[model samples]
Target: MSTLGMVDLQVNGFGGIDFNKDDLTAEELDHALTAMLATGVTRCLPTIITAHTECLRARLRALDSAICNSRLGPVMIDGIHIEGPFLSAKDGYAGCHPKDAMRLPSIENFDYLTEGLRTPIAMMTLAPEHDGSTQFIRELISRGTTVSLGHTRATRDQILQAIEAGATMSTHLGNGIAHMLEKNNNPLFAQLGEDRLIAGLIADGVHVPPYMLQSWIRAKQASRVALVTDATAAAAARPGTYTLGDVTIERGTDGIVREPGSPYLAGSGVTLDQCVRNIMNWHGYDLATTFCMARNTPLSVLGKSAIPSVGDIAECVFWQQHDAQWHVTGARIGNWQVHINS
Candidate 1:
């Protein structure tokens, strides 16, 4: 069967390559992206999560340089997704991001991060609970960057305010929240109820349990949802330790990535293809509906109009399914076409 190749909007690293490191080489970036393409991903955003100011800047420069220097980077890298250095520092809302590194949004911080980078910051995730978030959301959108709310305990009003200020998305909607919620007013309800926001969801059963995932897809109506890997170096690799920015995360044999001693998830080790299968497995959605979450919907949040129309076979994915598993047999990207031996 044929479909649009998957687009990953929030992948941190893949195939043993961590994009958070400032010492990555062009060859390494190419290797990681190649691994991604083999798994049916054609475009992605190399996400760099929260870090100290200097560390964040250094990592951005290194990633930008590697992308500019790498062969596959230009074709596969849609843009960069900066998850945070501006999220809620609360206990559970923080996820695996370093708490002390997060700060309130600032124009100076945004300028500092984007100073001379060749690759653009296509999307950024932040919290609406911060005092000046409304203005920062406005500034980010004004600069043509897609703004998303994440890793916060923002009330419904706060979320609405941020939406009014131009935040149009939520990152990993069901996963970045505090496990125990207020029952009536919470981040999940606030974001899910707002049709203005397209939710980026990590369908890895590890990040979100299967039953809840089913409900999330149902509530979002499956149309305005986007599937994101939010993967780390542990992704597409066997269980072991990996880097997510400066933090150390371990992927257990169960396929959950977390800090050495923490029970909370650090990042995921799921691939986009696996995620597509996962949604269908958990919710019984047809392939076409599931593919839209991984392909067209994400680009829409970024205001990108590059959706492949009918008969646009120039760039496409060829796949086959066996026993409920989807395998990427081959793909076409521009003038390039090759078989994937997976």
Candidate 2:
């Protein structure tokens, strides 16, 4: 039996550090990477959520430096998934992006933010409802960036139109929009009903229930689904006050959620390793399929040709199973054992 390795498709912050802050430091990036490697994630898309264009662009510039001349360990930032400022503001389904910062998608805005990133943006999540959004989708695809649908109120036809225009994915598929909708047409179902696109789901059990996870995996199959964390500063930190730039999360012993009086679950405190364990326990998916969903499948969605091949960026993890329970034993970074868990 082969042990599973993980690739996190979305993570905002880790080790009590946040990406959205103007003060985001390269040392914080190293801390986040080290923590992820300890939990068996070899590579990750360090997601930066929607914010003021200038703030996002500034963080990207700093992150580019850390990523290009990496002194960090195995949990390197392979690319980024810039997950919105261009999104709907409807309640119940929209993300935690501030109202002032949220707006329609524009190519000029995206270019400003991603100009200096070393790894380049692998994907961007936006609502298709904004003006010229379809043309924007085409442009990103043409530039070799994968576009993902998220934080939208798009109808089935609208989503299909965007898909036709080369929008290839749904970011955190079931979590970005309102929960209840008119029968047969919502962003969640619109995405679930389609097969041509890949969708990312947070399996931490807070975002989507077990039955929903089963249905998605059944509909899309393992190869077309990617597991994402969408984690924040609380990920590897002790449960307490954590900041995501200007926003704050109150992570108690009960897990992470938004601050007092808020109803939304902001992001997860779950590590990528914990996400794999939850999928295995909740759905009974095969280990190979699980690993592929967590790793190779996301790489494919980001438009990479070859994935995890020998002699090509030797990022891997070694874990042991005893009595059907797995534990991350170690991890690697391009032929070097970067960390070993006792």
Candidate 3:
């Protein structure tokens, strides 16, 4: 069967390359995208995580240059997903992101970070609990950016307010929250129950336990659930040390990416194909539903048209399904095509 090309809205890095690197190169970007293509991902938003304001801008400029100069980046990268600098700074909510860099959301800060960039910020993940986030989210929406809430401890009412202000998505739901929560009243339930918010889930099993997947998907509804890989350089690469921005992280043989000696997950090592397969195999889902969550739903969240047919676009993946197992037989992007195995 043929399906829309997999679209990952939150990819940090892949293979052995770091998208958050201060001096990202075109060759490195191509290597990462090529590795991603083998797994049937035809497009993605290269994510940039938390850093100091000035350093973050530098990273953005460097990444913008790599995308413009790289062979595959022009076709593979949809835009940038900025995930930080405006997140919950307290303990576990901060996760692997540096707490020192976290701050309240502001338009001036956004302009400073995104100034002079060739590539646009297609999406941003920020905490809505901040004082001015309601207005800030409105401003971001006016500029054509998709706003997603994450790393937050906002009350359900605050989340609703942000949604009212045009925030339409949640970044990596079921993760990036306080270590403990009120079982009856929490951000997780708020996002899961909100029909207007399309929640991004890292279906890598490590991010959210496998047993919880079915319930979370059910709570959010399949159509409003989109798959994402909050990947670091560890993704699609062998078990080893990799860089996540300025921090050095280790991908154990177990495939968990974390800052050295820290229990908090730095990012994910799972590819988008595995995410789809995991959902189908874990639950009784068919490929159609899972594929839509991975591709069409995410693209829709980014304000892009969904794939109505296999031939609707020049980029898509040809799949061979045998019971629960699925593999990419071939992938096409623009004029480029390649055959591959799982």
Q: For all candidates, what are the clash counts?
A: 0, 3, 0
| Per-residue lDDT of model 2, residues 9-118, tens digit only | 78888878776666556677777787787788777887878778788788777666666655562236667778888888778656677767887888888887787556
In model 2, state the lDDT of residue 328: 79
Please write out the lDDT profile of model 3 over residues 52-148, one tens digit for every residue. Answer: 9989999999999999999888888888999999999977688778899998898999999988888889999999999999999999999999999
Please rank every candidate by TM-score, starting with the best: 3, 1, 2
TM-score of each: 0.96, 0.93, 0.96
Residue 94 displacement in candidate 3 (angstroms): 0.5
Candidate number with the higher lDDT (2 or 3): 3
lDDT of 2 at 326: 69
- Model 3 score (lDDT): 0.90
* Lowest summed lDDT window (length 10), candidate 3: 307-316
User: How many clashes would you count in candidate 2?
Assistant: 3
Residue-wise lDDT of candidate 1 within 241-324, one digit each (tens)? 988888899999998888998887888999999999988887888888899899889878888765666664356788897886
Q: After the best TM-score superposition of candidate 3, give how far the Cα of residue 129 lies from its true spot, in angstroms.
A: 0.6
Could you say which candidate leads in lDDT? 3
Which regions of candidate 3 deviate over 4 angstroms? 308-313, 322-324
